[model samples]
Target chain A: MTLTINDFADLRSAEALEAALRAIGAERYHSNHPFHHLLHSGQLDKGQVQAWALNRWYYQSRIPMKDAAFMSRVVDPDLRREWSQRVVDHDGTREGVGGVTKWLRLCTGLGLDEAYVRSEQGILPATKFAVEAYVHYVRERSLLQAVASSLTELFSPTIIKDRVAGMLKHYDFVDEATLGYFQARITQAPRDSDFALAFVKQHARNEEERQQVCEALLFKCDVLWAQLDALHHAYVLEGGIPPGAFEPVREQGRVAA
Target chain B: MTLTINDFADLRSAEALEAALRAIGAERYHSNHPFHHLLHSGQLDKGQVQAWALNRWYYQSRIPMKDAAFMSRVVDPDLRREWSQRVVDHDGTREGVGGVTKWLRLCTGLGLDEAYVRSEQGILPATKFAVEAYVHYVRERSLLQAVASSLTELFSPTIIKDRVAGMLKHYDFVDEATLGYFQARITQAPRDSDFALAFVKQHARNEEERQQVCEALLFKCDVLWAQLDALHHAYVLEGGIPPGAFEPVREQGRVAA
Candidate 1:
């Protein structure tokens, strides 16, 4: 079902609006995807997990681009000031640090080559499409919608906790330092999503505006969900790999046809 | 593998560059995808066909937007003048005419709701991402690369002929009238692609520019191939439909889990 702006026609209060937005994450977030189930439950093999980390690095690398796109359109100094931190968080104050670098550490920790992950040649075509869509959505949509899209971060903390604990417990290759990206995001995401959620609630004052916010969150969920769907389809399911996507150097169990 | 500008270091002549671009198509085009084989070989059921038509309508509907984006970035009046015709062709001189309208007719002819198809809610997330990537590539890339991306049309005439002929021969529900979109494209695509090919060959004069052109065309082929990959993975291979994509009202063969 496609989400339309008219779906939240009756939502007027800020609390009600907040509830609607949270409801979208509850129902549509990538955490609900079966791939997440596989990842968090340690049901996937090392190569499959390698594929996950490798594909996810693309999304991680693009977060700053998405934020930059969002920031380029914002005129308010305060909003820009608040939002610029996200760019720093991902890109870092200098090279060899920040979230993207940390993600590279996780990828390398998984026994994948750093250059291969950075080149992003082996990632599924669907992963590229989905990540690019998020950047475009932020660039093209209304400020309310753009801010609301980041509300996916509002739900990320729980997933991060679950993921960190699950991966540490289940996977021998992943260690505390390797998962630094998620460890940082557990704090960073709440701080970012809190600001974004407050901004969305304050800005989206009417029914139509509220609906746009809800739909924006839904769209963001779709972005995240679609990425996992691609990963699961390509790496996990039988005979699911597309031509030209990343092939693991060592096939753990499921072999590419 | 990630296609880089360095990949075309040996190709200096337009003829060589053209061969390289066409080689990418021969190897990577959606015509080579399994979904197209199923589509053209009359292997899929009506509901599956409906899913194909409905999802494709999103792509068909976005052509004008993509063209308009390209035209918007063109400061050259002559270039814009030549390019604007594509928008006219897809959007039509009148409301009930044009390629998008004809695609709607094709959808309705395939038993899909016109409004629903137009809403584009049912398109796979991968489809949206791939199509939007094309538009974004045109908007952000050098104008030379933008024009080169349209080179997919160079290969479209053959695919359209095979599709129209195969669908007419195999499917009882479709007639030549309902398949007017492909018939129109049989003439229109070559004309558009010829102009685009000439523009790319003439503008991409040096080795670096030639490499960019090749990468651009390869990128466009990836865009097309990726969409089919999504459809095949979701609808044909393993019933791995992402949430909120079009669900066939009747399960023709592969049942959604």
Candidate 2:
């Protein structure tokens, strides 16, 4: 459903505005993409799965930079303090402990080497484009849009659950340790999304501002959907390996076909 | 093909520097993507073609804005005077004439309404993300990289040649008039890319700056490739349409058994 800001122009309560934005996600999020269907069902081949993880690391790595850009712009100390945790959440205290470390572990479990993955020398051009776009969005657009894009965290928990459950049940090679990232994320995503959603709702004052918030969430969804699309196109359909993406193995029984 | 530039080193000559930058485009440009093969070959369905034109319009439309941004930063009168014509080339003196208008005409030829195409309300999130990334890359990155990204136009004339030739040969519906955009682009791109290349070569004096120019071109390749990935995903492979991308009409024979 296409929503015009006018629909919520007269809204006085935050609850109604929140409901409308949530409904946008309920209907439009990446969880609804068929590629996700393949992912959650374990219908994707190992290469496809690897592509997902490798491409995702780009997204994972950029969070802190983009969030820092956002935090740097915030004048309010209390809000900056609250938002700073997001940077810590992704970067972690030491080496292999935080969200980025977990994401790297996920890539490692997929058989990607630490140095190569860190180099980002193996990711698809499309993945880089989409991920960088997210970083740029956070940096350039209004603070409200930055916060709103983070609202995709609103729908991510459900996806994480489905992904964890499906991979565990359908793929024998997958195990809890390899999936440590989601364990943290299952809790972390909600906390992050909740903070973001509340921030957006509270801060987005006029109808125009509210619409920008919605558009930001939609843009985040596209950032994600575009990633999957690149993976599917390069690995699943034409099988055209872009110049730098992960190389799919030559297993005969591979299911991506 | 990876370049390492850790310190500031001066260049030997503009010719050698221009060669290095062009080499970057040769290796990284998105004309090499498989999706472009389908696009120019007319292998894509009507919807896929429509999605391409529509998504690309976002990039085309932004040419002037990016040029304007670059112009805003330039301190030299001669440089700004030469650069400002890019804005005129894109936005034009009056409506229905400039590069943007010609692009919209191409979109109209592909079956999109002028208002719908112009609203850009329906462009894939990835397209907006990539294009916005380009604009911001110009805004924030080293001025050298900003100039370097436009170096894709260095390779664009070849892509334009192949695209026009292939489209004319493969599609019954496409004609030269509808592709006036490319015809103009043929001359304009070479001239533009040439100027940008010379500017970068002369300005980017050291190895570190040279490497940034190369990486900038790679970043730009990602931008173009990502746009195609979004279109391929939304309109072709996954068959899932985002809320507002082009809606494909299913042909009777095109349905899978």
Candidate 3:
């Protein structure tokens, strides 16, 4: 049951490679993580959900920056045109817009202060590390791998659908307006992922290049999954949150206003 | 109790501020983390230990780069003279003689391939993130806080004592020969941390600057702790190691020679 890059080369076509990559997503995506289960099932208390939103806002905010960084490295103007839309999508034309602005609304809906979330004063260190890892991955790796890694967008729609539905059904606080980010992503992610997939598939000519593409997707999956793991460890299992990260509800009032 | 930077402004002397900083170290440093306990107690298997060595090598390797970056920022000749030694200490006069070279030997001592370790081919994404965070930290933060963050070295000797003794006692494979890095650190860390502490206590004048210093040290602690957390999750708890990182002992023989 062990998978390696060597197994990727035998993939005869992009279809086969795409299927294997989706298989990896099904098996290992953050949706399968326990924290997501808690999130959807409404098992997490308000504070936990707040922590999730606040920590996740950091990730959401950085996406466009990373995408821009990735876009900056691409040589082709045509390709750059496709990738630039992502930055526009995440950072909308006006204030109180874009994915990041939407994510901040989710934090506000969860009862977190906008300033605290923006300050990143209350998010977990693990969240920062995980998110920054993705940024660094895109910046340092080959442009092909950078584009390929964003292929996690390939799987985001299903999770978003489940998440929006589950949050509506399970959590009282997260209403349609607060969860609007998912609505945009349902379309935006597929559009983005499709372009990226075709780009990677066409460009990766050799076995080594193909393997790098596959591995890039896998690396990104780890980045996302690792974010959840840190949340689970710090906020769930040990109940030992790092200093200056999100404070639990019972302890929130104690930290200075 | 939560600590604040304003309290330091009213301090009686530089020694008081230094004590407060050390006190922050006593409370918040990585020594309190469970992974450190697991590492020092030898509860980790050889593969877990190998993962530690492999990931930590990334941290070790970057110290010179960070030192160089830090040195590049210092304008004072006196400070530059003192800071430049750190880069020399890490890089050494010759290629195979410095801290990085010593760390490579530690990796090889733990059964890693020399070329693979030196190439940094298999390091965990989280490890790279943590180290990159450090380099970026030194690059972006106020010079005073950046110096204070290195104050973790002030606490390093004690952890080094525990790590060296416990690693040697419990792991039949470890020896003074393999862990010679810590022996050098025993003397060097104190000398380094002392200078850093002196620098921070003298330079951090205002409440905001003082708070920045405190936060920087905490940030550095998180950097160190997150590295261990990532290694633990990937190699031990979650059980999915990243591609190109250390293979478990069972798989090592199967990897290409």
Candidate 4:
């Protein structure tokens, strides 16, 4: 919990680097955010949950694009082959069978229109910015940093588990079919993270490089955390939604703990 | 005040296109945002103002880069020559006197550490995302749409005047010297917007193109509006700052209006 840039003062062992990356998740991942807390505890109503899901769909949809940006910069066939799995996973081998589709299903399961969500016309500007920043980071940063950023996947399985369980138990609107996206992620995240973490630990050969690795994770965490922050401010807190963002039809959606 | 995508049903006269663009500004500009209201009225304390100036420094700093992105894709020498002036204005003819440097001076004037501000280590992720999105918008969109987005400058003179006048009047820590950046922008923004507007008016050759122009401006409006939304949420409202964002040392900064 007390890791810092100074802690990576020397070239760390592979085990040490992995631990540092995990420590980052322990401290900064979106699972620790209030919106997720509300979400997993069933403290949020369907409309509030809908806002989170709708905004989140932007992040989900951008994953493949982000991966593609990363892959385009890479010259190694091995890395490209491994990285392309992510794009295929979300986009799927066939239509209506991928991570993006499942998330869309969750949105519709919450009563949002499919076209509106697909159009992304209602997404918060902050969401677009945050997700696009992730894509750009992958596109533009060092290959080590770009791969290090995906280490968020290391922590995703648990968050997905908590989210699926919480939503199913708390919201009448949520069901297994609707929540399949997270279910799929439980397996998918660990697989992706393993690849990324191994690549990072091996590729990041110096203390300075290790520091960048930590910063990359921290930035990625901020990307995920900020998306939820936008949602929490817009939907959970008194901060009004930004104009042109999604406005839920129903007002009273939170269930008191 | 009521306008919709339907309003661009015909590619009206150039005068009509100008009216609709102005109407978009009337209805959607950041001048209508509450954060500006707070800023213009001196309702924020030095710390809140610091957060605004510091975070806004990201937007201010990105202008030259955005212009350069816009200029990069211009195939016409006339357009490129005209557009490159924006870069010169922000970057200045010589070292240390451009719009970007002035904004940096404002941050230093606000009691934030010059190096820390320059590092952008403490900036809200939302600010980075929003500003970078603007730069990307310029880089990737149609040249006409990219120019149309700059039309937020169309409304900047009034906001800058109100801000300069109000901050000088209300905040003890502020002086005309620190606020000189806004004074410079008053001339700069209008001149840039006029050129952008004329380009949009002439180049948008049909109803669909005009509609795209309107949508681009709306997107630009959302970009400006969303930056304020993040500031208000993080600094003004109860929404806590994201991990690693600039946190003002003194919390009680908002002045009673």
List, for all models, the DockQ compared with the true complex: 0.41, 0.39, 0.33, 0.51
Backbone clashes in model 1, listed as residue pairs:
A1-B244, A122-A246
Instruction: Encode model 2's per-residue lDDT on B107-126: one tens digit a residue.
Output: 88877777767777668777
lDDT of 1 by residue, A136-233 (tens): 89999998888889999999999999999999999998899999888889889999999998898888888888888888887888889878877876
- How much lDDT does each candidate structure score? 0.84, 0.78, 0.79, 0.84
What lDDT is obtained when candidate 4 is compared to the true structure?
0.84
TM-score of chain B of each: 0.93, 0.89, 0.91, 0.94
Best by DockQ: 4
lDDT by residue for model 3 (A90-132), tens: 8898876888888888888877777767877667777788788
Local accuracy of candidate 4 as per-residue lDDT tens digits, B1-257: 34445565665677788888888888888999988999889899888899998888888888888988888898999999998988988899999998899999998888777777777767888888888888989899999889998888898898888888888888899999998888878888878888888888889888788888998888888888878888888888888787667778732231111
Of models 1 and 3, which has the larger DockQ? 1
- Candidates ranked by TM-score, best first? 4, 1, 2, 3
Off by over 4 Å in 2: A1-12, A93-95, A205-207, A249-257, B1-27, B249-257
Worst 10 residues of 3 chain B by lDDT: B2-11
TM-score for candidate 2, please give it: 0.87
Model 3 Cα displacement at B16 (Å)? 5.2
Total backbone collisions, model 3: 2
Per lDDT, what order, best first?
4, 1, 3, 2
Candidate that beats the other on TM-score, 2 or 3, i.e. the better one: 2
* Interface CA RMSD of each prediction in angstroms: 3.5, 3.9, 3.5, 2.6
lDDT of 1 at A81: 92
